[model samples]
Target chain A: MIAKPLALSLLLGALAVVPAAAQVKIGVVTSSSGPIALVGIPQKNSVALLPKSAGGQSIEYIALDDASDPTATVTAFKKLISEEKVDAIIGPSGTPNAMGVINFAAESGTPMLAPVGSAAIILPMTEPKKWVFKTTQNDGLVADKLIEHMVKTGIKTVGFIGTADPYGDNWLKVFTEGATAKGIKVVTAERFQRQDTSLTAQGLKVTASRPDAVLIAAPGSSSVLPETTLFDQGYRGKIYQTHGAALPDFLKLGGKKVEGTILAASLMLVLDDIPDTNVSKKLAVDYVAAYEKAYGTKPATFGANVYDAGLMLQSVIPVALKTAKPGTPEFRAALRTALEGVKELAGTQGVYNLSPEDHSGFDQRGLELITVSGGQWKLLK
Target chain B: MNMQIVMLLGQDGVTNGAVYALLALSIMLVFSVTRILLIPQGEFVAFAALTMAAMQSGRAVQLGWLVFALAVVATLMDAAKVWRSKGREPWPHGTLGLLAVAALALVLTKVLPLDRIGMFAQALLTIALVVPLGPLLYRVFFQAIAAAHSLVLLIVSIAVHVALVGTGLLMFGPEGGKTEPFSDAFFEIGPAMIASQTLWVIAATLALMGGLWVFFGKTLYGRALQATAVNRLGAELVGISPDLAGRASFTLAAAIGVLSGILIAPITTIYYDSGFIISLKGFVGAIIGGLTSFPVAALGALFIGQAEAFSTFWASSYKEVIVFTLLLPVLVWRSLAHTRVEDEE
Candidate 1:
């Protein structure tokens, strides 16, 4: 009688463990409290709004804060992969943070969805980079659009000022290539530290070059400094900023100086102007409304990048679920394959059309031309 | 670059150089008196600027609460120290003063229309809110370890800087801030148009430097502090409290830092983490003095500012590289010139 009861109890225990074992686990690492907190805080806040249940499986997110340090990012990635056994990972917010962990994610066969700015994380598309995918638009995509606008406006010569970091470095590389191809002469390129107290010398140099337009490529509010300095120095032709200047702080800090600035960024910046027929419009609206309700403020485009990462994972999890159980190595590998196979999937930022070669699968629909007029972002006519 | 560019860059250099000179003097003051490297000197500048920015935007300044909280912690620490020693030593000297200042700031923030107030009042209020932090921090972090070795003090100083930076992030969000310019008028001088704010920075820096010169030369407390810096044990035997000297120097440093912040906030954006690099530049200035002479340090900082400005014009990408590379030769020259070995302990 005792043996029979033991066998029955063991069967019940096995039944209890099966469902718990099948739950999908995802790891999220963000620089939620440090230098990059402007980007990381929104991404961290959006983590709560990510779908808890996706593709008939309950998804569990394990979040970590890297404090904007790259070494801490690697540690977080290792802990998540080794201890939590997370099937997929998202974020490690800044570009350098994400770039440091691509090898670890690949070695563990876990897919990483990085919501960072630099395209260097995915470009040169090495074997290890295959496990990593970017949710933000590529620098080249945004640069191409800005360069086209410059051409349309008959801007022949351009001056560039960017921060001396990877974000600026990549923008300079991409903008120079595109401008050169379009036969626009690049007159001067100056760089400044994000924490620089003054940009007077750079502003004077760029103004002296007398380019038809000046392009600035610093992220967040630091982008405002160069533009304002140029304004103060009487550079009047035109100013073109990169998508890095999409934050609301850009307007608040730049004030009257940035009144006529133009840039191309995600549709989220000009959501009201976007037609309802656009693929990403409805989702972006819903996200903005939900985010505003939750946080009492409109979410920046950086937040949408992470939310899009969630959407991508939500769309791909079911396909991955069919091949293997959630806790095994096969499941993580299958998830990576499924994410690559995602096509025509709409996210809050843009529609994803992932392939083997392109991990950041955004096209023209991902960006909209925006200009700052009278202290607000307006869709460019 | 032509004469016009030179004038423009020179103006920029002098404006920034003046701020760095103030910071260098304060760093030198605090280091000589306390044997502690003031790594967090720039945090005061950042906090004061952010506080000023918050006021300008009509937001209630939150720095008052931080001041109040730090003051309370400092008081508790002081009380604990007294209880442990079981002596009738006087209770913490500035706790009451700090608390009063904090409370006054909090009340003013709640009652006043911060944005409508003139820039002068906003600056004064920002200074009031931030200056007390200097003494409170000295009490809480450094007072107990005042007699520790210089290396230990340096390590502890770094730890405090890290903590304050994290606290800064919590207190002020990660966004950068710029305040309204002191004045909008421009001064045209020979090929260059100088912003009135630049003139204000230079003027304030000179005035403060002169004021410091008088204080150190005329005041009894200042002479006592100087004596302590010259010989700690001698000053102690002469009844000049080392602790008092430390707190006093920190207060002066904090005041200088906040003034620098107010002056420069209109010129550039400052983030919660911006202080380290700014103060590091000042530290570089301090090093150029071999961490000793005040006038040499001030001159060194001005030279650094000019080098930084000209380098930004010539090779923008390598501006920082060029500026920092200057320190190598200064260090080598100082080491080669001064062969006398003094015991650190």
Candidate 2:
């Protein structure tokens, strides 16, 4: 009986060792099919454009559709970790969806590189998010840029109209914090659902406050309702949108109404128009050429963020691969360490300088205040 | 808030309510005529709005092509049934009408310079492409299952809703589209200003309601639909085709939904998934009317619109909660006042 048990243990050990040279797998969870697919489709496309091989090992990217739901994201993350045994995970684009899997990522000791722009994803560097990293610039940084512009323009009071979800909540919190820090009084704050077709009531309240400026924090084209309502209501106050308005669809949807509105956006959005020596210029130009060449359209900022994540992963994987082979508990740990050690890597969105204390290795340098002028994005002077 | 603010909010509420009333009226019509809830009503709205967006961009819309293809399949089905059951000419008159409409839409899509055409004409073309989808969908998906139990039909409607949503996503892509307003004019009424689009929505809703009244009371076909709704077996005994009535109800529902989409798309961005939430709100209004009376449903939807407008001012985060919770008291009152009756097959 002892001899038979020893032979079974040896057989199991040999089986585990046989696939030591297997391809490195990266798990990706994106909202590829739901309402948030506005951002997720581009994210998936960017990941596909990444190099098929990394660190001399063939890479197998397993992409899952999360439908922009937190539960779906968690399930996809679990499947990636337990079933596929991926070396690292790439994304789940929306803030809430990305938030759903950070704790699981930490507990599993697997590295997660989220391409979403919410600071809370890696804020305070909590224990549960020790293994989590994000490639996108923090919302707080963009909020600061917005505040700086407001102060420079001598706008003292601002009103807020935000969505009712996590994206809205995150922006409201950060923008409020940033505004308060700069002594700008937020006169009134209003909320509406993303699917809401009417914002007359909210717009009325915001206009009633008579603030110097109104900040609309809703994401994507949904921002049009509140903005258009305010415009129709004859509110002449300066209007500002969040970085979420960086999409060209916003311009198309907003038409003339969004013209003259200001927002802090990733420099990648106006890469070609920016000064030649800008930090993000070179990387943004390269990304635009590669992406537009492949997909026949310029990638939105959401896709640029994901491309930054891909570059960050490429920069760190070679270092991780030097220590441990792929598809092992030890390899995942090394990858996490390697991701944390990624420093001064220029990306399409920013120069990533990942440290133990800051998983999102980006700062205010990556953002620029851009306005819609003459039906196109022009960097605000 | 001052009276001016109240008046402004009220104008906005009325505009939004008008659109909701249209959706609610259609939902009530379909439910009364056919027991199955029309879950995919919102999908029609989104599809219609997006089709208009495509036309505005001068791209030939695939919606016309889809309608043509669907009409072909529905005609084939109708012909097969007529051939086997009636032993007559297999050509369906209804199919002929649908095919003509489809052919007209396709021809216009090809020949018309959409950019050169006015916005009103583009909107008309969009509605034309969209309205026929209602009967065609009813014929293809629900006609055969018309006699199924309400629960089974409900399940099938939900499945159809999911399929349409997926199809919408594929056809429209992930981006949201908004069309230019039918009218960009604005006028002041007292201290409040009203957009011409709001006036357009109100005018369209009232006109549609009046038309529906005339159709139900004045037209023989409309009376047939009403009779079928009142007593399916009795109407059948009187030679009113229950199948035709069912198809008519669905077509009206689809038309109403698409009209609402056209009216509201300029006011708010219309995404593929937006229709579900907007239509669900309409369903809520329909429920408040006990899903029976058209006038009451319209009133309920207007009340919902006003309530939403007011609630956003008071507590924006909980506005949806406040609107939905209004159902509880209305439902309790309904239960207390009305006697329960079992549904008849």
Candidate 3:
């Protein structure tokens, strides 16, 4: 009688463990505080809105804060993969943090969906980056559009002022290549720290070069300083900013000084004005309405990248679940394959069509030009 | 470079150097008076700037309440100390002055229509709220350990700086702030047009330096501060209270920091921790002067500003490296030239 009871108990325990292992886990690492919190907080909030279950399988998300640090990002990634045994990871916003973990994720066969705005993270689709994908539009695509606008407006020479970090280096490379390809001479390349209080020296140096147009390549509020200084010094030339200035606070802080500044941003920023036929229009409207209803404020463009990553994972988990159990290494590989096979899926930023060679799946159609007219972003005609 | 370029660079450098010079002077003052390095000096700059930006934007800043609370804590501490000493010393005059300043700040922040006021008045209100924080900080954190070893005091200062930075994040949030230019008029000087704000920086720095010169050379209190800085124990023996001098030095440092913040906020976006690096740059200038001579420190800071401007033009990526690397050679020379004085154990 004792032996029969023991066998029945063991069978019940074994049955419980099998179903628990089938529940899919997704890990997220993003900066929720510190200097980059402007982007991180929104990303964190959006991830919370993801559906709890997909295709009859329960889904669990484990989100961690990286504090906008590359070291913390790596630590979070390691803990999630090894300790939590998450099948896939999303985010570690900012280019440097995302790039820091790409190799590890690829070598470990754990799929990562990075939400930063750098193309270099997924470009040249090599062996190490095969497991890594990004949701934001590529910097190269945005840079090309900005340069094209400049060329059309008779801008011959341009000055570039960016931060002295990997993000800035990426911009320098992309903008330089894009401008040079368009036959526009980049007269001066000046760099500043993101926390810099004054860019007077940089302003003087760049203005002295007398470029017809200047690209203030720093992100968020840091971008305003160079432009304001150059304007104050009486450099009456056209200025272009990157998509990083999409947040409305950039205008509140910049005030009247930012008026007339043009930038290449995702169409989601001005959802009402986006062409109805654009692939991203319906997705943008839906996202804006859902996000506004949830957060009581219009979502930042950076948050859209995180939301898109969530959608990507939601679409892939069902297909991957059909092949293998959730916690096994084979299941992680299956998820990676499914993510790469994603096709014609419309997201808030653009329609993602992932492939072995193109991880971002965004092209020139992903961005639009907008100008700050009267404390509002106006779509360029 | 052409004459026009040279003029523009010079203007930029001088304006930046003037702000650095004020910071250097304040650092020198605090170090010589108390033997404690004020590491959070730059935090005061950021706090003042953000507070002003908030006030100017029609937001009722909490700085007034913060100052009021600190003043209350500092006053109670003073009262307790006096009671323990059997009321031998009269109720502290500095405490009374702080209470008065705090009350004024409370009224100004609460009663005044900050948005209707001009930028100048808004800046003055910011200065008023920020300046009293200095002596209050001294009373709360340093007064009890005024005679502690310089290294210990320096550690405390770093702790204070880190704590303030955290608080700053909570108070100001992570987003950076920029204020409208105090004056938008442009004045053409020789080959370049200079913003009037730059001119204001130069004028304010010079005026403050001159005021300091007069105070040191003429007044009894100034002489007492100088004497205390020269020989702390001796000045104490001569009946000049070291506590008073320390408080005065901190007050002056706080004023200088707030002034610099107000001047620079319109030109650059300032975040919470931005002050620490700016302070480090000023410390470099102070070190070049051996932290003693005001003129040499001012000159060193000016050189740093000019060098930074020129370096950005030549090699933008290496500007900070160039500014920091300058300290190495100067430090080596100072060590070789001056005889080391070991502290008595």
Error of 2 at A87 (Å): 1.1
Every model's DockQ, to 2 decimals?
A: 0.37, 0.33, 0.26
Q: Given the true complex, what DockQ would model 2 score?
A: 0.33
Model 3 chain A worst lDDT run, 10 consecutive residues:
A9-18
| Candidate with the larger DockQ of 2 and 3 | 2
lDDT of 3: 0.84
> Chain A TM-score for each candidate, in the given order?
0.93, 0.91, 0.90
Which lDDT values do the candidates have, in the order given?
0.88, 0.83, 0.84
Per-residue alpha-carbon lDDT of candidate 1 for residues B1-345, written as tens digits (9 for 90 to 100): 799899999999998888888999999999999999999899999999999998998766777877787777777777887798787776767777887898898889889999998888998899889999899888878888899989988887887777777767766777899988867899899988989998898889999999999988899998998898899999999999888899999999999999999889989999988988888888899999988899999999999899989999999999989999999999999999999996786
Ranking by TM-score: 1, 2, 3
Screening candidate 1 with a backbone cut-off below 3 angstroms (N, C-alpha, C), the clashing residue pairs are none
Residue pairs with backbone atoms closer than 3 Å in model 2 (clashes): none
TM-score of each: 0.95, 0.93, 0.89
Report the C-alpha lDDT of model 3 over A112-221, residue by residue, as the tens digit. 99998788888878888998999988888889889989989999999999988776888999899889888999999999888766677788788878999999887666
Top candidate by lDDT: 1
TM-score of chain B of 1: 0.97
Of 2 and 3, the candidate ahead on TM-score is: 2
